[model samples]
Target: MSTVAIGLLWIFLYDPSNGPINQFTSALGLGQFNWLGDPNLAMVAILIVVIWQFSPFYMILFKAAMVGIPEELYESAKIDGANGWKQFLYITFPSLMPTIVTSSVLAIVGSLKAFDIFFIMTGGGPGNATEILGTYMYSQGFVNFNMGYASTIAAVMFLIAFVCVLIIQFIDYKRKKRGILS
Candidate 1:
């Protein structure tokens, strides 16, 4: 689903008086608790939204990586009396490391640009609890009409994202050079 749709859906889901979440909690005698309005929970609510939006993509990526793995390794592991857990710890985990690193890079870079859902859900509010670089940059540039500061924020975001990707790539390269790329 689109970010706008997800944001609007979560906003409704977070409605304290009538949202399904609160209603469910109330039914269980947990009482109503505000999801988005509470600063402490607002970031958690956004995190749930982010996870819901991106988890399926990660699943598919990992599935594809698993499918590409040679069957011989697992067969040999089985013959060697490696239990499921050991097979996973030894073969599967190592095999998935590259994909995991790639996913980490993608997640980090994408999170640096997260703005739409945060804007729609909380606007970095309940007292700046959910404020992120993207939201702050937008606020400075548009809401406060401070383009220079916004530009600086954008540059910093770019630099941070670039550095994150570079560092992850360097680590991955080192692992590969050490023959750990499985």
Candidate 2:
């Protein structure tokens, strides 16, 4: 589905009054909740939406990486009596370091620039409770017509993402240099 469609679907699913979530809660006797209205719930609601939307991509990445891992290694570990946890710790985790770093970097950068879902769902509403950098920048530039400040916010966002990428790269490099990841 298009981003707009997905956004609208989430809005429908999370509607404070008639959303499926409230219906389910009412059935369970947990009472209805303002999923997208209450300040505390709003952030949690956005978090759930963001995770729901992006987790599949990251899961696919990790799955592909896992598939590419040589089966022989696990077999040998098993023969050596290494438990599943040990095999995962010493073999699977190291083997997937690159993919993990890549996915983490992508998630960080994408989140920094995320705007559409938040905008469509809340428009930074309920008193700015869900205002991320991307939405804040949009509000400043388009809603408030403060282009200069918006540009500054955009630049800062870029810098923060860049720094995160650099940090991930540095850690990956260190791991590889130390032979923790081959």
Candidate 3:
């Protein structure tokens, strides 16, 4: 939704043939891609796009966690002379830590494995500006016909993902041991 708004704003604020984005790209000393015909804003642009795409899930998780917090906690914080910001800092945020961490791990995994969006938007072009692990794997196996190398990349991706999940679980376990797994 925010991405759509940004796109609409871009259309309103920039020219088609030579958009404000192009001017910004030119200032950065990068050339345009023949395929996209858009300037070399692919890196920043794709990062923005990925963040936008994943934000909704984060927002929903945040809202659900906030809603799950008991009202008594807020009342107690207020009774203890905690201001709004202080209550959020000492109460709400601590209570939400596990959920936040989980969401963060998911976001990282999703970003690492993302391919469809980058493929459709940039095709890993403009000099590999938006080449992610998944896109790189596809290029290696299909485009370059190096199945061995592609499988290697796949194994690496799996290892990274496994490590991430292990880290999340370890942190969760420690939190539980410390009685912090609220």
Error of 2 at 77 (Å): 1.1
Q: What is the number of backbone collisions in each predicted candidate, taken in the order shown?
A: 0, 0, 0
Cα TM-score per model: 0.96, 0.96, 0.76
RMSD of each: 1.1, 1.1, 5.2
In candidate 1 the C-alpha lDDT for residue 115 amounts to: 96
Candidate 2 on 1-182: residue-level lDDT in tens?
66678889988998778899889999999999998889889988988888988889899999999999999999999999999999999899989988989998999999899999899889887799998998999989998999999999999999999999999999889888998756
In Å, residue 128's CA in model 3 sits off its true spot by 1.5
| Root-mean-square deviation of candidate 3 | 5.2
lDDT of 2 at 140: 93
Q: Of the candidates numbered 1 and 3, which has the greater lDDT value?
A: 1
Judging by lDDT, tell me the better candidate of 1 and 2.
Answer: 1
Which lDDT value does model 1 have at 141?
100
Cα lDDT tens digits for candidate 3, 1-182: 55456545444333434666556656788643332434465566666656766788889999999999999999998998999999888789888997888896897688778777667666787577777898899999999999999999999998998899888888888877897635
The residue pairs that clash in candidate 2, if any, are none
Best-fitting candidate, scored by lDDT: 1
TM-score of 2: 0.96
Candidate 2: 10-residue stretch with minimal lDDT: 1-10
